[model samples]
Target chain A: MSVLLEARGVCRSFGGLDVTRDVNFKLVSGDRVALIGPNGAGKTTLVNLITGDIAPSRGQFWMGDDDITGLSIPERVRRGLVRTFQTTRLFANLTVADNVALAIMQRKRISRRIFSSATELPEVKAEWSEILAHLGLDHLAYRKVIELAYGQQRLIELAIGLALHPKVLLLDEPAAGVPHDEAPKILDAINRLPADIAVLMIEHDMDLVFKFARRVLVLAAGRLIFEGSPADVTADHEVRRAYLGSYADARHSA
Target chain B: MSDITMIHAPQKRVPFAQEAAGALTILALGAVGYFLYPDDLAFLTRLIGIAFLVLSLDLVTGYCGVATLGHAAQFGVGAYAAGIACIRGVTDPVALLGVGLVAGTIMGLISGALITRFRGLPQLVLSIAVGQLVAGLANKLSWLTGGSDGLSGIEPGKVFGVFGFDMYSRTGYLFSLAVLVITFVVLQRFVRSPFGLMCRGIKDDDLRAKMIGVSIYPRLVAMYGVAGAVAGIGGALTAISTGVVGLDSVSFERSAEVLVMLVLGGAGHLWGALAGTVIFMIFEHVVAAANPFHWMTMVGLLLILIVVFAPRGLIAPVMSLWTKMTRKGKAA
Candidate 1:
């Protein structure tokens, strides 16, 4: 598989303490990878670096053949690399449809003429409706984002990422704070996305991670500990020691 | 016709009808004011000019979430530009207006670069500094601006060679009102546009706006330029209407007063600026007729009340009240 995004020797530090140390990673097109790590294992920091939220202390990143290490977050998004925050970041006061519409609007070439009714534009409205429906959020299209439940907000965040029509989606803890029942739904949605779009999910739930991701990368203390198929990673002794411990054993017995 | 089609037809027509009615009422009012209040025309002219000035503040403060107390500096610069132009034998109103807009835009571009670098209280401080600098220049350049004595002998030419703007209140009122109405309509159109949405988005969340690919600085600079032009037009109107320009045009108190007018009506709402200006000026007229000190006290009290009770400014509360009353009447 051709690499869609490649990170070589990615390093970031906060006041002498290394948060992400020489983390080399590659996401090929159509890859569904789960990054699993204990708390403070620098999963978010790595995502931030890849998404251009923060510049790497030292390293290089490429999207396809283009080096994107110095690009801003929005510029990266425009280039088809989009990410969801660990916590949902939404335009709270705007309607759910408006949130998605804004994302669609940014992609358009028109210099937003102030007096023209953007909503009446056929292409813009059609795209907005399509994105809303795809996210199963059409019914709540006009609802304020802040009024939505936590699960709904998560879906809205996913919708925002989807609206960007990204080539690679970096989801920072998609299953975090999701109820058990709703967790499977989110995983199912991610599983059903177009094969051309790569998904790199950071998940703590082993069951969901193993089920959703074909491959898994485990991080411990900001360094890669294991990289293999979900089954192989599940069976690794050090991965068990770092994250699973008795939980992996308990699942095995069950 | 089908019930759905029949029901929706009027829904589409209602906005147009309301707009037509509003236009008629405004025109009627203007006509009545033109004929009946000839004595108070000069004061009315000043009110319209001040309204234009406050509208500039609304563009930055209300729409873009830029808090500036230095807009008066732009007004002062425009006034000085027009006053200087008049002294240099450029008395045509349109030419003076152009000069004011150019001067204001240049100053705005300069100040906007400085202001856009900082936000919140820091932005406010920088704006105040800009205002002080402009006022000091006006004071120091006594020969050009006439310093404390102020620029005099500003003979604005005949309006389209038909009406001469004399010491009489009639011509001044109509000219100022015409400018105010045109500016208001242009601003209304501009604010309701997609560009306005971008500004609103920036105001709502700067970080998110940047994330959405909006370069905040360029947009802010452009907005400042537009705002400066509007303010300059206002300053030109002030110069033409009053036939004089002074350092007080850029005074800190003038900035504060315009800010108060914005806050009083509703900062974000376009019509609110006009409403605030009219209400404020009328209140001043009434209270000053009683006692000048009493008017200031009343205005201060009113501003304090507005800040405490209607933090979103007077529009939101008035709108809520209007909606509630209408709903209640319908229920009854």
Candidate 2:
């Protein structure tokens, strides 16, 4: 399979300390990967660099065959590379439906006229209903985003990403801050996404990662420590010490 | 997608009816003011001009979230352009209108670039600086602007060559009111359009707007141009009505006064600006008539009270009160 996204020797330094050091990463079409790392291990930094949020000191990044190293964030989004933040960034005042509709309306090919009345479009309304129903958010569609629960907000964020119909979706801790019971629903929704859409997620929860991700990449101190199947990753000594720690032993004991 | 699911669409749209009733009320008030207060017709004319000015400020500051304290400079530029055109024998209202729009657009583009580059206090300072610069230019160019004495020979041509602009102030008042209504209607449509929604989105979260494919800089420039054109028309109206153009039109205090009107009425809503202007003019006319300095103190107090009690402006409180009263009546 051809690579959907590739980052080569991506290096970023803040002051004297390296945040992301010579990280070479790739996402194949349909690949589901989890980026696991300790806090301040440059997980978010890597995502930011890939999404063109911040420039790398020295490296090259590409989406499909296009060199997107210098593209603006919006331009990158237009090119089918989209990302969600760790913290849900939603238009809190707008209704849930409007929030999702905004994404569908912003598609590069959509006519400016469509933006004015996207809800009136059959395809747009269908897409909105389908996404909301799939996430069990149909009842809350008309509610303001601020009125929704934290977990519901995360689902809405995912629905917004899904609305973009992105070929590649970068989710920065989609399950973060979600309640224990609601996390499963979000993870299941993510796992069931069509195979044509690639997902690269940063997750702190090991059980959710093991169940959903096909492969895992481990980062420590801004460097990739390991990349392999969940079974191999859990057994790796370095991975054990750096990331899994007691969690790996707990899983083994279970 | 079941046909049986019947989404409860209201039989008659409530907002439309409310809007229609509001329009009727405004027309009735305008009629009353026209008939009952013929001697106070100058106040009504001033109200129209100030309303238009407030609307322009609302476009940039309220709609686009571009903090501008120098819109009066654009208004002044429009006034000067039209005033100069009138002095040079281009007395046709249509021609003067075009001149004002063009001139305002040019100045708006220049100042917009400077203001959009910085944000918050810096943007505010830059706008203030632009207003000061325009005021200074108007002051120094005595040959063109007449300095402190102002330009006096501005005799605007008749509207469409049929109706003459009489000295009774009725023709000018009616003309300005007509212009204000047309401008407001057009702006209302524009504000409710997709472009306007995008601007609101930009104002809410610029980073998100950019991430979603909105180019902020270009949008700001376009909005600035639109606002300048509106302000320019307002300036032209003032020139034609007052029969003169003065340096005070572009002064910082004038710009600040418009900002106050926007804040007092409501920032984002279309009618809020017009309401703010009317309230401001009324307060100034009644209060200032009693004592020259008392008007400023009263305005200051009103602003502080509005900011403290109704940060969303006077409109939101009025809306809440209306809703409560309606609910109470329904219960009764």
What fraction of correct interface contacts does each candidate retain? Answer: 0.35, 0.24
Worst 10 residues of 1 chain B by lDDT: B1-10
Q: Residue by residue across A1-254, what tens digits does model 1's lDDT show? A: 88889999989999999999899989999999999888767888888888877899999999988999988877887888888877887776556766676777776744367555444345766887887787777898766777788888888888877877888998888878988788876876687778988899998888888788998999887888899999898689998797754455557778
lDDT against the true structure, per candidate, is: 0.79, 0.80
Candidate 1 chain A, poorest ten consecutive residues by summed lDDT? A111-120
Against the native chain B, each candidate's TM-score is 0.89, 0.90
| Candidate 2 C-alpha lDDT tens digits along A101-150 | 66777773452441233343456667888999999999987667777899
| TM, every model | 0.88, 0.90
Task: Residues B63-83, candidate 1: write the lDDT tens digits.
Answer: 799989988988888888998
- Candidate 2 — which residues are off by over 4 angstroms? A108-130, A244-254, B1-25, B321-332
> Model 2, B178-250: lDDT tens per residue?
7776676667556644566567667777776666666788778878888888888888888887889987898
The lowest-lDDT stretch of 10 consecutive residues in candidate 2 chain B is B1-10
